[model samples]
Target: MDERLTIASAKANLEKGSLSAEALVGSCLETIKQGDKDVHAFLELSQTAIEEARAIDARRNAGEQLGPLAGIPVAMKDNMLVQGWESTAGALILEGHKGSYNATVTQRLKDAGAILIGRTNMDDAAMGSSTETSHWGPTKNPWDMTKVPGGSSGGSAAAVAAGFVPVSLGSDTGGSIRQPASLCGVVGLKPTYGRVSRYGLIALASSLDQIGPFAHTVEDAALMLQVIEGKDPRDATSVDLTQTTIPELIEKDVRGLKLGLPKEYFLEGMDPAVKKTVLEAVDRLVAAGAQIEEISLPHAEYALAAYYIIQPAEASSNLGRFDGLRYGYHSSGQNLKETYERTRGEGFGREVKRRIMLGSYTLSAGYYDAYYRKALKVRSLIKKDFDDALKIVDAIVTPTSPSVAWGLGEKFNDPLTMYLSDIYTITANLATIPAMSIPCGFVNDLPVGLQIMGKAFDEYTLFRIGATYQSLTDWYLRSPDTFST
Candidate 1:
């Protein structure tokens, strides 16, 4: 069996009678058995994965029409609320915490007959970029074990890249999905905010957080997005979206498309090799008939500063629910205040606490306008910039990061450096525009992600452009370096 089979290919194989869902699920399990230890991608393995595949086979034998994603084994990030499974969000505070119900996305996937493979590890409370902050353990890069798998969605990306699973759910609040996807050599989508339901995702930063898919191909990401998207009464912020259909983008042509390069993204401080690979990707996309245009997103320069302020402010408020009264870990204390502090301080990872403190400080009476409120105004300007650009271009493309995957323990101490990792990505969340990351090329044998940003609710353009790029190259098919080892 080809270990790197994509979701569409797997479905086709299942339909052609050349492969069985059971066989496919077993292959994924075998990959886990072979590689999960060295990679540390999964927190648990579902005994039900094989059984779920068997059920799909049973349905097929019964002549029932299965959904597009039927029989696929998908890994869920630990942060999503899956019934009968814990949604830890990689924090000891909520460790072993199972939701009373399945999150809307989980229920939707279950409806489409996707098997729940297991929960993958992430940074505690989704606060850090590297998976080293995971309460359980660090998720090493599949490309090079010594280097980091860019995270808080590190495990999700690693699993897909290593072929443990073809698709997984990852929540991106400031590039958790795309950054890790770039590091692990897979495709990650951060659909426009509210494109997918946040009803069951453990909130990191409510406004910034979005749960999307990680896959080996752009088509697969679109497929997963199609499955999980739509409005729900459960999440008031959920957008009223039309049902989407993932088309034949892989073999389709996208001639005369406009690809915008934000001047802010191409400026200095970028690694020469990453810049080179991304520029080459631009050439390839252009060769396929895309018109490259240089655009200015002046407010883009302030995205990081604005994001840090807004996200943590929302996070501090969202995290307020964790104050020893409800949910997971509660500490022994003589008074409520002690319980609150001790439970939070002890339960949360260091990075989470730091953010909380920063958030609290920013939102305090005297500092609110200077930090939180001011950041909101700048965020609006950034969103306006994207809107203006989208009017002139079909899609905007940029380097997913300033450089390729950094070595493990390299940015752990320097919080500012780690924060800047999402420079290219944070603006999309702020703008509430759909953006996606695909493996554009490699830098030093470590993959680099090429980002495509689209207009609000315009997921089609992003997919069309990304799918166009994928058709031009086979970077998406490259297996992780650890796969060989």
Candidate 2:
């Protein structure tokens, strides 16, 4: 029942009869019942979670073999399809839409004996950096209720931060997972693009979006990633690459490893406290025997601009299928065109509509060459920057976000500033590399994250660096005051 119990510890206890799956599941559900009202993390709680856990217990008692995450309760983002479960992606247009088939990740979790406890809130259609844009209202930062949890994966991050679940699944298009994890003081991992299948996930930006995990420890996140990562036949983009045993790999020595501190990431305008803490964290890594060198990713400055252009362009295209003629919310009109217009106008939230409009404009006849195509070329340059840099170091290090958690609604009206929140994270997605965020230290009583991005398919290196850093500090173990009891 301990909210701080990690997946490794819980799995050990469960296997030895020291913990029952039912007790663990019940405790998580009870915690959600008692605390979710304030955090607003979950969109819906699964009615059958306890029942499923009990079945796992029965199987364990019968000497049946179990999966890696056996009996663990995991909260999934609303964007992942769970058969017969409402998967709205935090959009009103899909409010009542239930998944007819499970997303590949959802089924993978189930097969691994993970109990999907509920659907967590997110930005409407995964279009925003703050969960405040969610149709169901914002998920409060567990560390400070008045502050925003970074999003659109904020709900999943808050769920773990608030002790509602040991781990949760979230998709990062531009930093949804890492930014929220940094704000919530948890470990979030975005695996190498194509290393994990995207089949069944509600697409935000097909090429940029990736499913990852949020957990209390780097090892826990690695374990979750191991359970869900693989080449799926349903997703053509998924690669058939050899998978590394990340949990075991993280225990390897980090000495002799070279990590890059990108000159572009240490900007003049970032929060001074965050910069101080993150640099201090880098010092700890140096003390742990890792060598550090200053590096440059010159295209980093343009990552944000290119990301906005590319992500929305793809999002607008993917979201086009949600017209009233399909399996979601609809509006009646005299004609098909009017129905399409009204359905989208009345269904999507303000931010979603804004992105769709921006996307439509960029992809239009004249602007396509000027905007979207130019963004694509810039994206290639950004990827080259990372590729050229990674050839020198094992991984790239940077701040996960510019600042710590901000007050809810502070920047809701300023779309430009909101977009800036993801400046540090979008490049990983753009580069198609593996990245992770681990709690470094606190700034103004809120957590800051040190982001480590590795070469494509080199998640093992990122995990190794994260696990090494975590061992050098207790930041990951410190729970928010609200959930520390």
Candidate 3:
């Protein structure tokens, strides 16, 4: 079996009897066993995976109708709740916490016959841009062990990149999914704010967090999204998309589509090689008949500042429930107030604490109007910029990140540099729009992602453009040399 088998190829082989669910699962488990020591992608392997595979194999032999992702091994980010599985969200505060209920997304995947392979690592409470902040230690990029696989969804991206799983679910809040996908050389999607349910996902920023998929190809990403995308009563924010189904996006016509190139994204600080490769990709789209026009997103410069304030504010409020009472870590103190203080102080990592404090201060009485309120107003302006631009163009394009994956420890001591990593990706979350990252090219053997943004609920267009662009190039086909056994 090919190590880098995609969801589409795996499904075809499984349906045709050329591949058995058990065999596919075994192969993936073997890949994890062989490579996860270096990548540290998985937090814990699911014991039910083999049992589920055996049942699926039995059903196939008995001629039972299977679901869309039948027998496919899929990884879930630690932030999402999987019943009976420990979900730490890469934070020690929730260490040994077992989920009693499945997140809506987890149930949807299971209903589709996807085998839950394991939970992948993430930044503590999804606060950091690099996986290095994870309490379990960083998830190394498969392409280069010393480099980080972007985060807080880094483990999921690295898992897919390392052939541990063909598809995985990750939550994106301020570029968590897309940034890591770019760094790891995979296809990652952050759906429109209400497109997918957020019921089981641990909240980072309630308004910004969205659960999405990571896959090796655009079609696989589309397929994964198709199964998980629909209204759920459990999530108040989920929209009713029952009447609308995304069309088969593979090789869709993109000839006459207008793609806007955001001038703000291609600024002075980006890696020269990354800028050249992204421009070259745009040229390929132009040669393929898509029209490209330089567009101005005037408020994009303030996106990062607004995002940091809003995200941390929301995170501070949401993470308040884990203060050593009901579940998670506990630190004893003489009084209730002291116990609360001690537990939170000892349980949270440095980045998590920093954000919590920042959020607390911003939301406090004296600073609320000056910081939090101002950020919200700026967020609206940032969103207006995209809304105005999308009216004229079918989609927006840019480099997913300023540079490729850097050495793991390089930016850990410099929090400001780490925050800048989400500079190109945060606007989409603020605007509540759908965005995707696909491999555009490589710089020094590391992958660079081409980010595509679409109007609200217009993921179909992003898929069409991504698939068309992928068809014209083979960058997504390239895998890490060390993990390509």
RMSD of each: 1.5, 1.3, 1.3
**TM-score for candidate 1, residues paired by index:** 0.97
Instruction: State, as a TM-score between 0 and 1, how close model 2 is to the true structure.
Output: 0.98
Model 2 misplaced regions, further than 4 Å: 1-3
Pairs of colliding residues, candidate 2: none
Clashes of each: 0, 0, 0
* Tens digit per residue, CA lDDT, model 1, 246-339: 5554345668888899888888888989998999998988888889899999998899999999999999999988976678998978898999
- Tell me the tens digit of each residue's lDDT in model 3 across 1-485: 23467988888899999999999999899889989999999999998898999999999899999888999999999999999999999999999999989999999899999999999999988989889888988899999999999999999999999888999999999899999999999999999999999998999999999999999888899889988998999989999974344546355568999999989888778999999999999999988899998899999889989998999999999989988988889999999999999999999999999989999999999999999999999998999999999999999999999999999899998888999999999999999999999999999999999999999998888998998888888888887888776
Residue-level lDDT of model 2, residues 394-461, one tens digit each, is 99889999999999999999999999999999999999999999999999899999999999999998
CA lDDT for candidate 2: 0.92
What TM-score does each of the candidates earn?
A: 0.97, 0.98, 0.98
Stretches of candidate 3 off by over 4 Å are 1-3, 247-251
